[model samples]
Target: MASVFNAVDSISAELATIIQLEAPDEISVTKKDAKIEELMVMDQSLLQCMGVSHASIESILRTTLKYKLAFKLTGARGGGSVLTLLQTLLSATVVDKVTAELESCGFHCLTATIGGQGVQVCFGGSS
Candidate 1:
């Protein structure tokens, strides 16, 4: 079990490095840990049901960190969500690809209204 955990951790770290390399220039990926709140947002049971491994979840968490940083740097007002900031700062194709990647990792991205705003991306569940 210990060896399995170590292997998973190693793979997660490698995936994080790849994600950092692929990230947009404006978003800087770091080795800092993700906040508990950010980690809690993901649905663990759903992820398990969708066959997402622990390594994948770790990668997603790292990606979420990058997204949060990008949101803050883009001058998000009144506590805007990361998805909203992404939509505003990135092209539609890029946003779609992000969502698609999330979907592949066992997350579902929904279009929802927030604070009377017409459309926003909500990541949860599985699809």
Candidate 2:
């Protein structure tokens, strides 16, 4: 939640600049309130196993493909093992980016390790 809030604040700031430049006093700040509400709608779509698998961490890379930031993972695949779809790699990147984002939002991500069970996530935040 803190991550989301922080993202909202940052994005809203950027958008506010654009809005003001385009419309000036023509519109009110009420427009941003809708965006704030939209960001609060959490995207909880996922499965338990995929959350921890190394193969699932490349979601960010997959997103890059769609956005033509395909430029990021430049060059071609040669030798060694075959490449996997961008989707399979997205999970880890998502976790990493979200962790940093949440951290930047003033939240501490509590990670607990369990024998044979793996790392469990404990979500907590401070405003």
Candidate 3:
């Protein structure tokens, strides 16, 4: 939740800065939209620092295809992976082949699942 708030706040600040630099006009709206896009790119770059595994997956996607990819922290537990948006239409086979190639190159991949086991709780009086 904090991260979501942070991203929104940062984007708001950026839009403000862009608006302040321009006169009130349609061009100002365009400029603010551009700044939002820029913020998305910066957020992707920040994802690179999320840890080695995350970085590796992001690298794989970038190397495999030309797509608008963004990595976001998803779910209440703050977990997620690279979210791909198509710039151009791609065949499903291409995605499958890329996944296979990544696996062959030794990156583990998993489907997103929900409601998994949680940490076991032993309710004996604390020491």
Candidate 4:
């Protein structure tokens, strides 16, 4: 053990890079107040009803998105405006039910890009 330690100590100090230590800058956002305000407006009533703790909900949010569920209750608005494409090698019946559910929640089921590509679902509504 003594010899091993000596050899390690004697090894040339010349190296591409030595051990690096750093104090990283703070990870922060300046405009979070506005965002938090917006989310509060979006579903403040529902959030109050569900009894969700502030700490847990804050953990899941970033600058762009927030997904929160507490006590088995998903929030008022689940998804947003986007294209959802499902590429199925074969046909099935249940897919219709799925689209119906989306529409009920207010999604516009647009063109089905068939055969060559996946099924494209475009979701949008004023509400």
TM-score of each: 0.30, 0.20, 0.35, 0.25
Cα displacement (Å) at residue 83, model 1:
6.5
- Please give the distance, in angstroms, between residue 30's alpha carbon in candidate 3 and its true position after superposition: 19
By TM-score, how accurate is candidate 3?
0.35
- In the range 62-81, model 4's lDDT, one tens digit per residue, is 21132121111133356222
Candidate 4: what lDDT? 0.34
Ranking by TM-score: 3, 1, 4, 2
What is the alpha-carbon lDDT of model 3 when measured against the actual structure? 0.52
- How do the residues 1-127 of candidate 1 rate in per-residue lDDT, one tens digit apiece? 5654465456456545543443233333222223212322332323344454456445655665555522111112432123322422345666676677767877655654323434667779533
Model 3 Cα lDDT, one tens digit per residue, 32-96: 54555566556555544444245555566564544333333223335544443322233666667
lDDT measured at residue 77 in model 1 versus the true structure, 0 to 100: 40
Which model scores highest in TM-score?
A: 3
Poorest lDDT segment (10 consecutive residues) of candidate 1: 71-80
lDDT of each residue in 1-127, candidate 2, tens digit only: 5665565456557645543442223233334333322322221112111242233224533433343222111113331111222221235666566546545645444433212335666668633
**Off by more than 4 A, model 1:** 1-57, 64-87, 116-127
| Backbone-clash count (model 3) | 0
